[model samples]
Target: MKHSGKVPDFQDFVECVEKANSGKINTKVLSIGDLFAWKDCTSKQNLKCRGEVPYARDMVKLTAERGITYLLYSTKYDEPCSKVLNFLQAMLMKNFPLP
Candidate 1:
């Protein structure tokens, strides 16, 4: 009953994330660069960018306001991701109040 090619669904991914987060993914992240190349495991797709430093900073502030312990950012081939990680590690390691 299929006449045209169809794309795969991401239902499994959604389920996985929900389960992994234990139905509570309070911690969020702001990816400022390519964050999918690793998923692809190749350079066929381009996803490099720069802006994670400021992004992470903003995220930290937001998380504080929202009430979270930590933020996560898994990026690949992203200059911003590298820069932000370095900056976060070097500085901004203080207590943040939540709402």
Candidate 2:
């Protein structure tokens, strides 16, 4: 499985998740990104952030393909961030209905 810290882009993120869903990753915890770094990167690369939803959908499909359970955990302290996370979670659930 491709390690998380090495994820330079969306493709890498998809690969790591796919590996985990496939049971090829034995690590108990996979560090995908630093929260602060992710926030900063998103701010600087706003255009690239447009792919977030598509990437998320890809992850959902891959996880479902392997019957792997997944969840989006948010630690945002503000109301707006919480709302955004909730919306994203809803969209994911809508796109990938539970069995």
Candidate 3:
């Protein structure tokens, strides 16, 4: 994602999951676009810019507690909070697989 500057086609992945389930299941994408927007807005206000300023960790924590699988398509891996976010679990370090 850092090298390509592109988000993956999340819809295609959802479709594949639906097909694999014989169209019996549906998937929801909790996009990080809104999170990025919030971070930008907070920056404009000169708020506290801690490593966890965007609080992606909080969202991930909720998902973990709820047993929800998180498939993140992030443009940043070298970010300050990347390590703190525990990327070792499901983080895809490679660029987004966009054709």
Candidate 4:
């Protein structure tokens, strides 16, 4: 984000969600990337993400801040979103284990 001004990054996602949730309300969550993309993209893309922008981590961090858990991932594709969700969630969970 600092160097790559055009493309988005982790901080960018955080800022995007923060700006989107701009209000006095302390309880709000938003995510442009669903659970599938959130978890999958994190590893696939990581710091070298070079595809469409994502905001799943933004949503995760935002919700986590508010002590929210159990994020349900949805997909608009034909291949069951739950299947993708399972893989993606497992991928992310492996790296970032719950403390």
Leading candidate by TM-score: 3
Error of 4 at 45 (Å): 6.8
The alpha-carbon lDDT assigned to residue 11 of candidate 1 equals: 53
**Residues 1-99, candidate 3, lDDT per residue (tens digit)?**
233345469765665666664578776777777445432212222223333444555333222322322323233544332222233222322332221
lDDT of all the models against the reference? Answer: 0.35, 0.40, 0.39, 0.39
lDDT tens digits by residue: candidate 4, 1-99: 354356456666555545553444343344665333432333443323434433465223211222322333333333332312222233545455443
Candidate 4 or 1, higher TM-score: 4
lDDT, model 1, position 39: 24
Residue-level lDDT of model 1, residues 1-99, one tens digit each, is 032234255554444555564578543443644454322122111123333234433442221223433344434333232222222221223553222
Model 3 regions more than 4 Å off: 1-9, 33-99
The TM-score measured for candidate 2 stands at: 0.19
The residue ranges of model 4 lying beyond 4 angstroms of the native Cα positions read 1-47, 56-74, 82-97
Q: Write the per-residue lDDT of candidate 2 for residues 1-99, one digit (tens) a residue.
A: 335667788767666776776667654344666333342213224334545443353232121223322424333333221112222232344354433
Number of clashing pairs per prediction, in order = 0, 0, 1, 0
Structure candidate 4, residue pairs in collision: none
CA displacement after TM-score superposition, residue 46 of candidate 4 (Å): 1.3
